[model samples]
Target chain A: MSGSGPGPTAVPTARRGRRTVDLPDLVARARAGEARAVARLISLVEDASPAVREVAAALAPHTVRARVIGLTGAPGVGKSTTTTALVRAYRQAGQRVGVLAVDPSSPFSGGALLGDRVRMQDHAGDAGVYIRSMASRGHLGGLAWATPQALRVLDAAGCDVVLVETVGVGQSELEIASLADTTLVLLAPGMGDGIQAAKAGILEVADVLVVNKADRDGADQTVRDLRAMLTLGERRDGAWRPPVCRTVATRGGGEGVAALVEAIDEHRRWLDSSGERARRRVERAAREIEAIALAGLRERMGEVRGSVALGALAEAVVAGETDPFRAADVLLAQL
Target chain B: MSGSGPGPTAVPTARRGRRTVDLPDLVARARAGEARAVARLISLVEDASPAVREVAAALAPHTVRARVIGLTGAPGVGKSTTTTALVRAYRQAGQRVGVLAVDPSSPFSGGALLGDRVRMQDHAGDAGVYIRSMASRGHLGGLAWATPQALRVLDAAGCDVVLVETVGVGQSELEIASLADTTLVLLAPGMGDGIQAAKAGILEVADVLVVNKADRDGADQTVRDLRAMLTLGERRDGAWRPPVCRTVATRGGGEGVAALVEAIDEHRRWLDSSGERARRRVERAAREIEAIALAGLRERMGEVRGSVALGALAEAVVAGETDPFRAADVLLAQL
Candidate 1:
């Protein structure tokens, strides 16, 4: 409860025991090769405190420099393999990378699939590389409540490329679409009819279409089907061709993954061309700012949202006694 | 430009457009034998409008008279066919029936495949029936924005039973899950691998597992797989055993259809005996009340929310310069 809402307005004036962190200094420390400092900054961001807002506000300019990418698709589509390749690709290019592999495997279920986190353990020893695992956590937007901030932590930590691996095919993937600079939708062959269902909303935000394990049988049919679907489903703006790439991520067969990277670069150009992407970027910024203020607004007025008279008004609204307009006004006036 | 955000002040006087709808009224109207009213009203709910809220707000006490059932699966699972058969079964029973078929197929698409609406035209002229085609107008929680409101329309119109046919695998199914009392997840045996992917999130919402087109190969395997998956998955506190039923909907070989209906009846008794269904009804009531408040909030803030500043603030919020609470404060402060 202490950090639930915006920090206490009065107590906020005094800093002791608040545990609200100084992210800018930590960010600088992390940039100076201190992983612990980067971790501390992420902890602060997850802290739901107004002071954290102040830190985020101060760090926003520094954080926006990194390129954020979201990788998503069906399970068994080699997203982990693709992600590992991505990390290697970026690291080979001398860029620091951070990876968040978010899947929903129950912690209590201990077996073959018990710990998916191990798929990412290859990054354990690599310098200039950081990887973490997250759960479904029921965050409808795909990431955790603290995910965007965690991304900001990486952003602040000076990771050149931050990759987000989504929980798959839900609203959360859509949420990740909004969070990343480019979204790569990974689809394997043999989904046949399921792709029609997948082409609809947030999943379509992908800047690149990755067909992993393409060396397998039915690759051509899958590619043809995907191409037909993509063709029939004209890009709303033709902003990007949504190029399909064939990759055998396991053997690293398709080493020229740089083409997909180039597509993202071209998308940035299109963003500049139509100015829509720039507008989108600007919109993202505003959301981040507003997120700061509204994080604890209602909680700041605790019990106000649950008063007796207010409760009566809510019932009246329900009972058709008075309009909801009167109800909200009465509540706002009380506040 | 037209409909956005909570406006300043509060709810305007319930002038003209307000009281036209809601879930209960639509439900009542549908029960009263108003087909056109039912169609239009379903749309109103699908839109998630205040009109729906108003109608729902004025809702009277409703008995647990109707069996609200949902049919869902990957596309091509013959949900539409199964639904048609299910309706035919109800018609055979001489019961008043309602079907809300969700058609995510863009009305604009001119393909050889009969529009889902046309495919479902079988129930069009029945005196004892009402049929509606619902479109997922973009943002997909599923019940079309108008579904709940339309459901009310059907209820008031007096359909003894209501069936919602939803998209198999889209986020739109979530809409049906939230609205339906009993959800029947339809699957074709061939899409076995796809089933594993779906089992992650949408599967657990099923009250009944339907493998339509039982004449098709892999029918037995699909049933067995689903049963194994169901058992491997955890059970809810009052969760009904989602009896997996096999039916060849296209062939009129749906002999097992009656048992599916009986399972629903059995589940309803469980609802009463275990008190879980009552708990759900109470929860739905709470949700209905919340929806009312949420819908009326925007109409109340007529001016400020409609202001030019919104366009500007949207940009600013995206820019990360202005905090959303401060934005709300400024907007509200105008009142």
Candidate 2:
């Protein structure tokens, strides 16, 4: 595969019979800021296609280090609205943006159908914007394995900032935090989200705390509650404390969006100045590599699952002749 | 480890500095109907202790093929009440019973708190019943890695029946279904649980559908909705259709308890007659073996994670000289 080499003058298509995917040409188009090519690349990644390794290798040299901002909260915290506002704010600054709405809990890709369409349609005509929704229906490693590849696609496609939005529940919250440079944990007033967030351990992952729908009742009380929670933790003298910002995302003309953007920018500055950006990037890369290796090992195990050796071991276990741990050792030895 | 064989009069205790655990004696006592020994064996499994392999090996020959029944539903669905009632009925029949309340979402082992304490107190004095709560706080593979070992502990302790109850949510619902011989998906009336169950794909795993809180209003509506949903799917000839049962669990005189037990017995007969019991057992054992193997592989990867080879690869990826897939391949080759 590496012998093909990646360059503009190289053969674009490696044809396998009648089916053809010009991965090199596709990567070239995506790097040239073509939305269709970018969407197709993301589709390949989401599908876990056989050529994904080739695509990744092709896109590696084009990565521009796009800023990744993760937005997560409970189901009804105005995540889509806040995301729309952020997109508009970024577009106003003439920056290309990509959005990946990852739903690890849902088996279907219907995240775009639930009152999010109208907001997302605002970016439908922009050539500089690419939006996609990925569901964890068939993924073996689920969101943790897929999201980073999608993010890499956006970064190599010349996006200045890529926003990843997901429901803040269970393991997905922490998974998102690990993949992003700046993590925003969104909440709203009168939703009892403060207690739930704390219980979920969502507070520790936040680089910015966003209280969307700030015009609603008890917004002040919500901000005060967040402040109280923040003060309970001790930080080093120069450590970056997550800033709590309030926004009425439904208001016309993007009310309170400027301050939120400024907060993100400030966090980015801190990350760069403290050498935390390089550190986080290296850690994320390490995790991505580890996930891929584990996935390969799992695939190998799945292949061995149908072998007579495993069948005999399983039968021995069922017959009470051997324990699972011993059977596992035998199976691993065979692998 | 196998050099020390299990026997009646073999050396019981294996001393390691300040700690001593007698695996053969513990298994012997557990098989002779000692509740404390059973509890200690399960604690070893829960803690993922080094002696767990020995415990599993020692307990293998004493397996009694206990009936594994899984109870799962959303919170506030009276799971604890039904569990207590089932325990009472089983004990009244003079059968030894065990209950495992596995909470995969909670970081704390407080499954016995809330209103469950009052119901659980009814069984505190019974020697034939053993009840314990396990939280998936520190396990690398969550409930999937830990639950089966705990179940094995109970099964080898000569319990005629073991009830495994868990909150029916995203992944845990499916995990519980995989571990049970008979899975009861519980629903309560007027809770909007029907739609949620359908969305979570919880209905497909049920061998028995239970509508608890049968005395409440809308009980008939919930049952009808469940029946309507069930009929939408097609089943093959001789296939066992899940029976929908109603039970007012809080009522005195074990309301509907006899009928529920009868239904479970009927399902068990079908499983035996159709050879599915053996099939399920073999499949369950296969899964347990696979989970153990994957966990062992994960530990090896974790060890390699701190090595300089992985660090260099991660740095190369961050510098855009390599992709994660290629880095993962290099790491796996090193392994």
Candidate 3:
């Protein structure tokens, strides 16, 4: 069986003087609740390491299909606080939880913001919780390619729930929503957030609407505005309506967090009973497969990019000897 | 000879009772400076019409490789006003200009904002000027696919210079900069925009910087801040350094507009003298061709997305029967 599995040549060999990575051993350790092992697996995924394919293959059978919840909001709407509160609530409930804080706006990777680090310190000593931050790293489709793999690492490591928190802005918000089983769109009062959300078209992706800092003035008005806006868009009679839950995330004792947790559970139940959970998982897996395939094709294209063949084709297009579409066809043929 | 070109079968046939596009005739008229013909050609590109491949072939030989100038800044930073002022300056110099205002944030297409319409009225009747607004239509890689094709339409329509203006937000700013021969990063007073620009990494794409609303308070401070930031980034010994230009775009008589035009021309000269123009165009064409080819592959992937084969593969992955990378390989084989 070992010989029939990924052969020695297929696996990435260790460099001189470096310790060989036994992926199977790492996966076993991670499954046994070793935080260091889990972190190492995620690091490999984040780095797009050559051994990632083997790592994925090793981790496959152990994955429990952890429930994914996405939380997104504009900066300073208390996303970190809300996420911290959610993590604490899940830990109190005796559940293993994971958090992936994705910062699409930041170009650097692995550096969590000072506030995120401070808030995450609450779970520092708790083996039941894991938190990591991933940055864009300036590659085309970087987040789309890496985020799901990291989720898989945490999922296989026995986290029952994983929360993906992202700074909701153009493109990235929708991307994160697509990766989650449940999505929370957060807003705050006095931010003109209701109209802004409508304009951003973010309302369409919300599985749960969160008004954080709900103790602030005009919180009721914000909720009303969101409800009114939600009514404006027609939905199928039996479809799940995203519930609005108000939370003062900064309050002690995880104020309003239990209600948020209940809302998540209700959405989960709806998903299961509606047969949407199975359907969504299939869809998500399909997307993952497609993304990986496309990334492979893109890598091949990159190889052809500055080659003499492509240079000649591009020069022909620039010289008006051929059109870009035809040039592209010639190049694609090479690929 | 006509048969030797893109065959009649390749041309998109006119549906019953619908007028034929006559792409060849449209291209001819557009080359002869007919604005309606130019608009028709661009519409075909924007719609991603089936005839686009043939249209590109028709327009290939006529393209003059128009100079592309990209203008981007945050909203309320006078992008439209500055664009208007630049168009006036170019018109005064007897150079035909084209403007493509791309709003990636807007979900609707072809609907220019009221502010844009009012500002564009400055040259409403000028046949030498062409202005169009392109909005994101929510497709994957929408702007990346369409904007370059539209630029081709305008370049082939005999514009001396084509200006692409986009809101300087996440991702779109970098996209527009990549498409331009010269990129202008605009800022205004009292927005703390210098730090914002630095944080966004927009400064690295700027070939020239503009301080619009230069008459406002803190304009000098803004300029100083930008200069200080620019100095911190190391450049090659002989690399072209971006110049900071001050412009009150709304002022009458096109305040500082001539200097801005001169800066653009100077940059053009440097692009030519440094062999950067040839290098940049080749790189841009390579990217454009790559985008078109990837889009074609994406279409094929879309076809397989819901197929029984893909469904089985996705189900297997979800069931832990296989990893996504292996499933993706199977799907790629089918493609």
Candidate 4:
């Protein structure tokens, strides 16, 4: 399907093989505070091949154990501001951090205007904190596919905490739910229940609801409305209540948002404890297999497109000379 | 990998001698105008089993003989209104018609609210008319995995023309481009540049730009703006020139949009002349193979989910001792 991303039509022509890029060594260097290696590795994974994907999958087993947190919200709701503060807090706790700010639009046009991309001021020159941004054009599942792979890369790179950020744009934001261990849904004061949010199905799945820019007017009212809606139904997973935390991220007023972070960790354990994790994994595995199969089936369709009997069969159906059921039966028997 | 859909999760436990479903017979019944048979046949093909999907691969070649025209745009732009008008015209021209409405909403809700569905009063009870709605919950591709298979059912059912009505929500509408011979982007006048329509990727893929509700004021201006945009780019397929049509579908004014339909037929001939169809069919075959592989991989992922190797690998990655490339390799190898 030709969705937002380019199709697999761009044939590399080069014989498919494992990437020459030394991911493990590059990751090791990043762990030793080599920023360039980490940058190269990110690009390497972005443009990876099936063989490279295989290699990444193989090595992911031994990567660092880090609680990967995904922070997402509508654009301009202070997600970057919130993430910057959180990074500082984690660093203060003596944890090396990796931040992958995923913004898809910038990548498409940046081959010429790429200079403007270095505008992220938070960690441009920080050795201790590694940060990268990706475009959406080549991203299949947006951050979902990329984040999981990138998380393992950072894990091997010695980052104790990997923070992923997504610019939530309408229905596409749901991609975050699949990627994060603890997905925080960031909301601003007084935006209320947007007509767009209701249509997109975002309000129903927030793991940790955060009312950021809390210092603004009407913060309490917004929180109140969200709480009222959340209270209308019993929580899906009772162990983790999505507590609404109010945070003034810029001035670090609610720097203790760590408590909310802790709650998410608690929720993760609860999910595993309740067998939901296993259920989800099984479900995902099945879906992945089915999706890939359908994709593959579509690819291999050419080999059988020209069976002489096939055309006559369809024409017979169109001519009402045969019923569809019998036609399918005949076709299956031949196949 | 798997979101919410009844995909094949657990590996099939039955003997592999034959499929659980009688596919060809079911397809034949669908061709004979049985809605239930059509639904069941689609379900049989949308599976996580390589064998069942092998049926789809075997069956796809015998299908896809009809002229596929896609209709889509932002919600409440009166796509259903335009669709009914187009259907009536197609019928008057003596074409056997089948309408596949791709609705992302749950089928249960849609069926219950069928009264609210746009009523094609003229063709409501016509035996030649077949209508079905598809839910968006299943499959990795927003287009149902069974769609190509279902297309076969309709093609074998004596359908001379097939109209694909898309939900236009998420990226499902974009997939319509690849599936259809002609794609009509229905835009209502006066709602200039809605976030949905402004998405450049979709705009670029449209084969025909349609300004619906053309009777409303400022329709001319909207048409001017749309026409201006159409001339700005080199089109996706070099030989085809996308055209724009304005329609007041409710009154059926300016309803003669069949010129684009003829253009699409000519384009098919062009593809054959340039040997593009050969390339397209080749890629299609590859997709079928890919889909089958994906399903097989997912079904086998269970064998590795709870293994000590999985746990040990995850723990190692958690400890920052491995890279993702190696982890991916290990996981796939285990599968």
Q: What 10-residue stretch in candidate 4 chain B is worst by lDDT?
A: B7-16
Tens digits of lDDT, candidate 4, A1-335: 11223222111112223446665676567556565655555565555444445546544445436666778788768787788777767766778787777765454421222222322344444455666665544424344444555666676677788887777775445666655556788888766443335455666557788888888898888788778776764766455666778788777434546776666677778777777555443333333323332333333333344555555554554444543334444544443
Q: How large is the interface RMSD of candidate 2?
A: 2.0
Higher-TM-score candidate among 2 and 3?
2
The lDDT-based order of candidates, best leading, equals: 3, 2, 1, 4
TM-score of each: 0.57, 0.78, 0.75, 0.63
lDDT of 3 by residue, B202-305 (tens): 89999999999999999999999999999999999779899999999999966888899999999999999999988887777777777788888878888997
Question: Across residues A43-124, which tens digit of lDDT does each residue of candidate 3 receive?
Answer: 7877667778998898778654789999998988989999988888887788888888888888655535565566545565
Where does model 2 exceed 4 Å of error?
A1-19, A69-144, A161-177, A182-234, A241-269, A304-309, B1-18, B71-94, B101-133, B136-144, B165-174, B184-233, B241-260, B304-307
Q: What are the per-model numbers of colliding residue pairs?
A: 53, 0, 0, 77
Q: How big is the positional error of residue A71 in model 1, measured in Å on the Cα after superposition?
A: 12
Q: Write the per-residue lDDT of candidate 1 for residues A88-188, one digit (tens) a residue.
A: 77777889887766664422111123223444345544557666555434222224345666676676666888888874665656767777777888877
TM-score of candidate 4 versus the correct structure, residues matched by position? 0.63
- Name the runs in model 1 displaced over 4 angstroms: A1-35, A43-51, A57-284, A290-335, B1-32, B48-50, B58-64, B104-121, B138-141, B172-174, B193-203, B216-239, B287-335
Q: Residue A31 error for model 1, in Å? A: 7.3
The DockQ score of candidate 4 comes to 0.11
lDDT (0 to 1) per candidate = 0.60, 0.80, 0.81, 0.58
Per-model i-RMS: 6.2, 2.0, 2.0, 9.6
